[model samples]
Target: MIVSEGQLIQSGDPLLKVDFKNVKDNVPSIVTPIVFTSLIGREVTLEKSGFQRAGSNNMISIKK
Candidate 1:
């Protein structure tokens, strides 16, 4: 899904594709309770943020 039929992709172009088969459909909901319990009370702060450029596009980068 990263590139369209006629689209171009270059080096470092971020491409992520996820396939959801029936076997994997319930994974998130099953794991959410266990994961959320540890994060019930917490403070998260984003410390650094910037953009990385490739070709004519700028992609945002964030760090904790």
Candidate 2:
């Protein structure tokens, strides 16, 4: 799962951001056979990073 409570992540940034098209449209981009995230155990500092939020996103569901 995406870790949104680290040292770098913010409120509106891409916490669990993922696109299915990246798997379907460009299969070659995925070096692995699974849909697991490879960003774990890494340090990311977004203090000076310039990124844009996606315009539209699918409805999200949070299970407690």
On TM-score, the leading prediction is 1
For candidate 1, the C-alpha RMSD (Å) to the true structure equals: 13.4
Tens digit of lDDT per residue, candidate 2, span 1-64?
4664445764466555567676768675634332324556654433322333555342232222
- Tell me the lDDT of candidate 2: 0.47
Off by over 4 Å in 2: 1-5, 14-27, 30-53
Tens digit of per-residue lDDT, candidate 1, span 6-26: 567775776555554653775
Tell me the lDDT of model 1 at 62: 26
**Top of the candidates by lDDT:** 2
Question: Against the unseen true structure, what C-alpha lDDT does each candidate score?
Answer: 0.45, 0.47
**Residues forming the 10-long window of minimal summed lDDT in candidate 1:** 29-38
lDDT of 1 at 53: 35
lDDT of 2 at 32: 30
Q: After superposition, how far is residue 42 of candidate 1 from its true place, in Å?
A: 55
